[model samples]
Target: MKTYNLAFKYRIYPNETQANIINVTFGCTRLVYNRFLAQRKELYETDKKSVTYNTQAKELPLLKLELPFLKEVDSIALQQSLKNLETAYKNFFQKRTAFPKFKSKRSTRKSYNTVSTSNNIRVEGNFLKLPKLGLVKIKLHRAIPQNYVIKSATISQEPNGAYYVSLLTEFQRDIKEVPSDNNIVGLDFAMSELFVSSDNQRADYPRFFRKLEAKLVKAQRELSRKVKFSQNWYKVKLKVAKIHNLIKNSRKDFLHKLSHELVTKYNAIILEDLNMKAMSGVLNFGKSVSDNGWGMFTTMLQYKSMLLGKQVIKIDKWFPSSKTCSSCGNIKDSLSLGERVYNCECGHTMDRDLNASINIREVGRSLLAY
Candidate 1:
């Protein structure tokens, strides 16, 4: 059986009173999770072989009853975090790793997670009543699968003072066979262009930050002119936050969609697993910003493949993807990043990136573990 996590974010219309309550709820959940984590640790250290999720969950009903302020927007979520802590301990005991820490309250944004009892977050008309919070008006856009059980629903605040909910769901399914188009592809992620597939397809990288750089600078300037914690400072900070979030959202969306397109259209994708951080270290900081999107691209490709039923074969970082000959398998000693054309003395010539991509694809076909 396979599990798929589907998350959707919808903007919410919340008045000041609702916003205040939401903030408090966020604080309350964080505090509860942290307090429980501390107690769990003490119990385990003081000679108890184990503390299960059941113990942590038993506290929630009483906490809710005592506080009465914590709206059950998500009861399952509170316990699920505790369960996750148990899983962390199991991993630590078996694998000898670091223990999990408490959740932080104020960093960027925090979420209150809830389990969907009906596998659906029913919105009666335009208003939806969450567990502890009364009616919250949200502009519902799309409908999700009701058969799939909702594991968690996370409520977060956008930079523009807008609230949104992300629903995480899972369904049991049989193993799926991905459709093969008899298409083998190689990917060369580079600085100038985003990527060149083994099939010689080039995608343009949309540099979002470059487009909004001026606006961000202006927002920062406005923020600097205002006193910290003042109304104006908060307003300016929100503007800056909005720009940053937009850039992040845009980049993630682009990568996710591109990965979906490649996995759906082709089979047997091969890519060079370069050390992006190490590569960036050699270049000056500013020079790396416009081009370092390979990490995001590769992550999307790998995780998305699990759902799409495809394989992403990663060639070693040291592999000479550009200098190596696809025809004769002769490895060249050195290749310059600026050189766009790859010419081998063996009389093989191709676009530098395309040549690299072919080498990666051929490697995947011949030596992949399969």
Candidate 2:
């Protein structure tokens, strides 16, 4: 049996009162996280020891007494904030991520997470019953698996005042396996296009930011002209945030659809292990590379392939896919970045990205054969 953890997110329409409560919960969670982070840092610096989660949790009641506003939100949400901080510290020590940083109220996104209890959390007709905030209208775009266990929910508020809840659940199930056959392709990342596959298929890159560049510039200029923190400034800020969120949403949607298609159609999918951070340092390509969202696309491909029991092979980053001739296997000593076509001494030639993709496919096949 295979065990899977999944999260399903849906848009929520909370009434004004409920929205206020959710915003307050966000503030309380942020306060709890920041306070504990400060405490841990100070204790470690001064005494060469750190405050653990339980020890700090014990101080929550005292702090709440001193700051009565904290009592207004769900207590469990505040505790979850501490748990998040603990996980962040663990990741840092394990070298998985950078050190945890302080969150800001000026941040465009805010969220609070809370686990489900037998009595406090459940799904009604069209509403989700959260701990403190009662039934809020939800758009059940898709139904959850009946056999899956409901674990926790995270309530998040976007800068445009839109709310969403993500449910994290777990279940045991068999993985869906695809037949191993010729339905395999190696993809090469391209700046002009999203990717070029060994089969000569092209996935076009959508320059989402470029599409909205004019609108963003106008909104930002309007925002800069306003007095900071004024009502008009807040309105302009929201406008800018709305455009940014639209670009993000569109990019994610395209990546999801494309990844799904690749996973469904191919049994073995191979790609080059690209060092995107190093590539971003190259002049004139940083903005285009960031806009392409290659990292997110690869992440989506990985998780989707794993979930469906498909094979995803990543070739070595240092492989000379571009320099070697795909047809004759002749390795050239040098290949310039401006070269659009690859030429070999053996009189074989091909498009640079296509030739790289073909080489990648052959490499993947050789690896799987062993």
Q: Which candidate is the best by lDDT?
A: 2
* Total residue pair clashes for candidate 2: 0
Q: Please, what are the lDDT tens digits per residue for candidate 1 over residues 109-228?
A: 767776666534555678765655667888878765666655666778766667887766677666575654456788887675678877778878777777788898999998899999
Which window of ten consecutive residues has the lowest lDDT sum in model 2? 361-370
Scored by CA lDDT, what does every candidate get?
A: 0.74, 0.90
What TM-score does prediction 2 earn? Answer: 0.95
Tens digits of lDDT, candidate 2, 284-318: 67878888899999998988888888888898999
After aligning candidate 2 to the native by TM-score, how far in Å is the CA of 330 from where it should be? 1.2
- What is the Cα-based lDDT of residue 204 in candidate 1? 81
Each model's TM-score?
0.80, 0.95
Clashing pairs in 1: 71-132, 72-132, 74-114, 186-198
The runs of at least 3 residues in candidate 2 whose Cα sits more than 4 Å from the true structure, single-residue gaps closed, are none
